[model samples]
Target: MLPSVTFLAKFSPAHRRTITASAIHLTPWQPSSPQAEHASLSMMADKCKSMDQLKQIHAQMIVTSRIHDTFAASRLLNFCALSASGDLNYALKLLEHTPMPNLFMWNTVIIAQASSSSPFEGLLLYADMRRRGVVPGKHTFPFVLKACSNMKSVRCCEQVHAHVFKFGLDSDLHVVSGLVRGYSVSGGIGDARRVFDELGNRNLSIWTTMICGCAQNDSAEEAIRLFDGMIADGFEPNEVILCSVLSACAQSACLVLGEQIHEYIEEKGMELDVILGTALVNMLLRTDHWLKQNSAFMD
Candidate 1:
């Protein structure tokens, strides 16, 4: 009986290691011979894939006193809250119990809130971060601005803009791009353009944002004009830019311009890709008269 018990104990550790390694990366606590309760807690954390799994893990941890370890508990909270399939509530609960959460901990929760479908929570988290005297960093602004965009809260966006200026991050290309996109999404194309114009050196993403803003506002002519300017500026049109240009053509039924773009795509060897080819076909079909005339000319 003693030999069998020892064998089972040894087997449990190896089995847990195998399971953890297969599902997620192993943590240091995983290899230690925890008490039966701690061992079970580790096992629960290993198998957590959804909110329900996290809840089971939490219950097991509570029963096993494994929650006493702050680091392990914090990790559990992060995993449960931030995992693709984990529950937000579970993560929050873990955070609440954390004695003195670090910046990383705060950032993780803030990001999780920002990325949730209801972005208002992200804004709230930002407010909480501020109240706690945590200085917002470059990483924080994008997520905060994204939440403002999602909520279409222009006032909040303006407030965030002020924060960006205060942080001297207003000139950051990525932050500037986010501000442009946020303004555009909030139906303030003028504001977006204003931000774009202030950019020191515009990248393709900034140009794309402006183009998309024009297209969404039924200003395809403006988008096309901008596309021409971008090309003249010697910025090679990438796949995203090409897609945006094609969208503008489809909207305006500018078959002549669309054909020119199609030709460019062919020359660039992008026409061989099924996705772009399909988009080109759809654009041509939308202007069938022009396509037929072009085919006749070729024949």
Candidate 2:
């Protein structure tokens, strides 16, 4: 009988590896009907709550000559690369083995790597994809752009921005938003503002991106200005935007503005999320201290 998942979890890391290797070696299989084959493989993929189970299932795929099946491979890749429980190295190895991976496979890997701790891998994958002459789709650019944002790679970001324009994805909201965020995170606040201004009708996310970007890059005054403009334009502040403006208020020690924002939060019935709550508390404390010192000097 196959060892249960609970049993595998109890094993030491070294013991788990040995068990995985043994399971792969002992498992024998013949090609079943196509539908049945995919069903079985997919079932295994979905039930992969641990890395060991994934390895054994992958070994089964190799033995059954189903490794080349893009659907099956993609499912396995999704578990290993994208899911929090899986390993990026294993996913990369799987992709390397596939002979001339199609667009779906390439995009899947890029998307997974972009959101991983090592976002630079996604940027590298984009370059590799271009070298391989793989045509990028709309879905492709956002993932790459997000990687740019995470890496704060303004140079790569500008190059990707040009690519977005070249591919006529300049009008895509997701692509534009990614570019705005990328530029902002890279300390290119002017470039981010340029992107924002170019948009004919700005959404709340676009406003929030610019505001938060300013706040993050130590341009708290600019963040406040953007927040005021966001309100003037009639956009209701969400928790994210509120936290950002509140942060700016705290940094600049703008007590009146902070109090106004606190009132806005109460009037709007917005929840005080941890970030917002912290920002508000800090602002109140700082403002109180400033007032007390000024009064003491007068006395």
lDDT tens digits, residue span 1-299, model 2: 22245655676554554554566443434335767866777677876887877878775566445677887888888888878898878888878887777787788889888888889999899889899898888889989988888888899889999998888888777778888899989888889888888887778878888899999988899999888898899998888887888788889877789888877876776666566677777776776766533432343
Deviation in Å, model 2, residue 98 alpha carbon: 1.4
Best by TM-score: 2
Weakest lDDT window of 10 consecutive positions for candidate 1? 1-10
Q: Write the per-residue lDDT of candidate 1 for residues 1-299, one digit (tens) a residue.
A: 00122333444554644543444433424434566546556556756776655554554344345676665576676786688877787677677766666666676777788778878888887888788787888888888888888888777778889999998998888888888888888888778888888887988888988887787777788889989988888888887667767778988888888888877876765633555555566677777766644542343
lDDT of 2 at 140: 93
Off by over 4 Å in 2: 1-32, 289-299
Predicted structure with the largest lDDT when compared to the true one: 2
Which lDDT value does model 1 have at 115?
Answer: 76
My TM-score estimates for the predictions, one after another, are 0.72, 0.80
